[model samples]
Target: MTFTLGPKATSAGYKLAAFDQIGSTNAEAMVRARDGESGPTWFATTEQTAGRGRRQRAWVAPRGNLASSILEVMDVSPAVAATLGFAAGLSLESALQKLSIEANMRRAGTEPLQFALKWPNDVLAERQKLAGILLEAEAVAGNRLAVVVGIGTNVVAAPEGTPTPATSLAALGVQVGAEELFKALAEAWVEFRGIWDNGRGFGEIRKLWLERAFGVGERVAIQTGTTKVEGTFDTIDDTGCLIVRTADGRRMPITAGEVYFGTAASVGAA
Candidate 1:
């Protein structure tokens, strides 16, 4: 029940710290960054006492769920560092696939699930949220950026009473543990981060992301700041900005926002 860093992480020069319980792995990682811990590091925990999501929304990851954060020092600007969200999402997807969770679902007589990646950093199975990603960044000396990518996934139990429908691998009859998934995730992160090539390979990343995109060409509402715009989910541009077309035929490139996939995706990171 302990979290350990495998060769995939250590060989890649990534350090890891684990806790039985913590206020927030992302917060701890950021604290390390501020304390002169220039790292490609991971902070993981079994339970989160004060977790949070984008826009400061409360994020609850109970024991048996996978809650982890990565602190990466990058040579790029803050804007470019945000692109790590895309890599994180893809890494989660790849990890799940490597674990063969879907095959287990099929053995349980459930039809094959159509997994999709939502805008920003959410993963969906049958259009329901299976995982979420949150990215935060800060600047250091020499214009270097320290970005933290927080990933939370339901494994043994899914939270009830949420904005949108939530699901876990166990709900779909896949037997998995947080520690096992974390191992796969560590390796997967190495692969995806290499593919990202420090923001230079975004062209390839964007293409792969589009291949697994969810709700493309579908009507949705994206809230940025005080403005809530309804539009069709277009595609992520080369720079990782989401492209949306409004009712007025105006195209908007949203740098970041809360996307509502109509009524179904009202998910509060639930």
Candidate 2:
């Protein structure tokens, strides 16, 4: 099938490269960045046979889902990369709201799912898995730097047999087309970049993320490669670690890991 660009995507400042299938959009973008591709470019694909998640787990892209990678060479420090993930998460939540699913669907229960932002990267809807963001960096030829930010939205179907519950916009009964969704996402990123570029700070970004955060201050469990810790869901640290308050009242900081909440917790893959 031929790939199509969003109606709002202009070819003037941005290049939209599409593929029918690829191993992974993020991987491809990283390769291109290493080869010196510069500034505000996007790589999207219909299907990713070998997609990847935070820990290199397989990220299956069934047909109709949105898989794209963004390349940028911002003059920001690497510390700022973490906040960009939250910024992207906020942007995705905005797009989902634009789709106008039921309020309950967006949040989940009484303390509904809040469309919270999972640390580093991952957007959660109703406490179930909804979307993920991956960031990779490479040093340029002239001591410059570039970052490839991969974003995957389950516009249709999700992978099966996963530990964390998976969900999609279609499954949630939202019928917005992928083209429209992509437009909203890209626009959101552009706006987010402006805030990030200025010294607007991560405090404001963290506040937005926490407002919709799922299980914040609630009991939670996190597994980071063989170590599992149960604690109260605290706020995300300045550097983007999800701070978890342990049983002994000590806050254990987590940089990257799988997190879940409740007895039937909906975990998100980092």
Candidate 3:
């Protein structure tokens, strides 16, 4: 099936550039922005190679997976622009829920899949990593910040022996296609992006995100560079930092790190 923007996205003047195969949707979007394409445009593909995740880790989407990125050029600070990734996570989680419910209805006794947003940029299905999000931004010529939020999902295949155990929708019996998920994602993005409203409505977004957050109130460990911090997952701060309540009653706001939970938290696996 071909990828197309949902009606809401098209009506809102958002454009889509779908690809059967691409090196990286995020890279393509940034290149377009640098070439004077100021947009709320989506660059999507079913197969992605040479993709980079957070911390410059290689992220390759096999032929049946989905890799998509949305580019937005705005006059906002990098800090403010970073919060858009939360909205991106919410959008994908909403889309996955919609598709899972539909898939369950067609089956005899299947339960709906549970999806949650991992801190910073990931979507987890039943606590297993199902998708990853990467946010990249650069300053453009007109003093505008071109931000690309890339989301890659495992629709049919999941890599083995990852830091966090990964799972695909097919493995979970959701039975969704890349094209179908992309359409639902485009529609969900319109709603969340409207609520984000160029970062002015981050307060509402933060509240909504916490409601569907994963690992909150759980024992957590984060590794940043050579240092490791162990604490209870408290909440996310106003600026979207992971707020870990460490020992001694201190709420530490971690800006960036690799996260671990449960037994993995103590072992420092990632």
Candidate 4:
């Protein structure tokens, strides 16, 4: 009924603040961060009335979904802190594998489900999005900034109408709960933090991420700025940029874009 730090998290000095409902956990974390709250803490809620994701997409969490934000005062710059997206993605994937589905019953006629990482912070199960991660940074005192990592996972039910195909653990015949997922995520964060090592170990992070990445060699379309580019989903660069190989054999390194796997009509949310 309450959020408490696991053994690893507690040893790492992490804390959790649980709420029954909130406008947005990230908003609350940012507000406190702006007020000089440099916390290695987490702001979690049972429900969110005004949850938002990347590009300000409205996130709908119907009670059983997991909606939480982890705020950390980093010594790195805003640009460096942006790499938390990758860390968060890897962490979420680990958490899901740790406690994703129930084996007693199967949904979608699948026995054991799997979770994979999509570029730019989305986690997928059998190619459908099961969770997403959003990273934001707010300048605090001096050169340091407070990085807020927001995670939204579909638990009991997936969104009805979505740009991309959506899925939930329950839909996959997994009976995992939000609290269980959150706790696994908190511990997973601690486990991956050493590999991150404040970005010094990014090379390893990038390598591990690529191993669990989804849509590695699939045809994909990306909408960048006002231009749209279609190509094969090549490997992500060492710096975490999505590399797409066009028809002309030219490799394009995209830093920021909305990527959709498959056809033009398949251009969904990122």
Candidate 5:
């Protein structure tokens, strides 16, 4: 099915650029931004040939999977722009939950899937990584900053033996297609983005995110380079840093790290 923006997104003046296959939707969006494409535009595909996730890790989406990115140019600080990723996470989670419910309705006695937003940028289903989000920003002329939020979901395929175990919508028995998910995502984005209000409404977003957050108040270990920090997942601060309450009663804010949970937290396993 051809990709198109939902009614809300279209009415909000958002545009879409759908692709059958692409090296990376994030890369395409950034390239467009460099070419003076000052947009609230979406670049999406079901087959991503060469995608990259956080920390430069490869995030290739095979055929039948979904890889998408949205670009926005705004006059905000980089710190403020970073919080936008939280909104992206919330948008996708909302979309997934809606579709999963609809899918479950068509079947008999099927348990509805549980979805949660992971710390920083991931969506978890049954505690397995179902989607990842990456945000990139660059300063442009006229003192405006161009930011791209990339979201990749396992619609029908997931790689084996990842650092964190991965799962797909098909594997979870949701029976959703990339086209349908993208349409829902576009609509959800419109709602959450309006609520986010370009970072001004992040307090509300933060509260909503924590309500659907995974691993909160649970043991978590974060590895930043050679250093490792272990503590309970306290909360995310105003700027979206992962707040870990250490054993010594210090709330340490982690800006970036590879996270591990439960028993894996002790070993700092990949």
Candidate 6:
């Protein structure tokens, strides 16, 4: 399982440890990061046996697709830590562009295939899902940090039991190799980290992210714990909270929840 990228095959200061099979690349990277393994290290597997998504949902990854996780050391606060999800989305958008997926920031007042960011993570190609991200953080020695960001993108095949209409890069007529996509994502993350480090924080990334946002200003639904809120999508704050404007005109900041959007009649709620 060799992972190489482009013509020059530039390594992004991260060691790639590819597995023919593993339970989860994130889980494996977590183990390595906690045991004094210096990161940013990447773990990619051809077949992930027990891949998990947000909320413990099973991520069905076949052998030929991209299943990878990256572990890095950071000194940011928890608030900044939360914004890594958007950073992941932006980085994936870069990788998608490299793969020729037509994943770009749509202009204002333009209606393309609305590929948006759902809350913290998850890139949507139209209303259907195209990619997912999961960020896990652990305390290291003396205020230092280790965070493993897992990314699962459908390059060749999508699982059957997904509730929404899902698509793959190949399905969208973009045939990309797994190794090439991984390298592109690593390079993209390098640029994303720069945005976070320059103290402009996620503001720049948020602006670019919003341009690609699909359901902003539309009627949407969200579920947090036992509470379900229906409201109009508003803006994203610096820390990546989805601001929902209720019917009564109150702006609610949602920290964590499942989000959905559609027409007023068929607004899908997960």
In model 5, pairs of residues that clash are: 163-270
Of candidates 4 and 3, the better by lDDT: 3
The RMSD (Cα, Å) of candidate 4 is 2.5
Cα lDDT tens digits, model 5, 72-180, are: 9999999999999999999999999999999999997989899999988999999999999999999988999999999999999888989889999999999989999
lDDT of 1 at 101: 56
| Runs of candidate 5 exceeding 4 Å displacement | none
Candidate 2, lDDT over the whole model = 0.73
The CA root-mean-square deviation of candidate 6, after full C-alpha superposition on the true structure, stands at 4.3
Cα misplacement distance, residue 210 of candidate 3 (Å): 0.5
> Over the full model, what C-alpha lDDT does candidate 1 score relative to the true structure?
0.84
TM-score of each: 0.91, 0.85, 0.98, 0.93, 0.98, 0.88
TM-score, candidate 4, is: 0.93
- Off-target runs (Cα >4 Å) in candidate 6 are 5-12, 101-114, 198-200, 264-267
Return the number of clashes found in candidate 5: 1
List model 4 lDDT by residue over 200-248, tens digit each: 8778888989999988999888887777877898998877889989899
lDDT of 6 by residue, 53-159 (tens): 99999986898788888788777665667677788888887777655633323224433344566666787775668888998888887686778889998888877
Candidate 3 residue-wise lDDT at 265:
94
Model 1, runs deviating above 4 Å: 101-111, 262-270
**Deviating ranges (above 4 Å) for candidate 2:** 1-12, 101-114, 198-200, 264-270
Model 6 lDDT at residue 125: 70
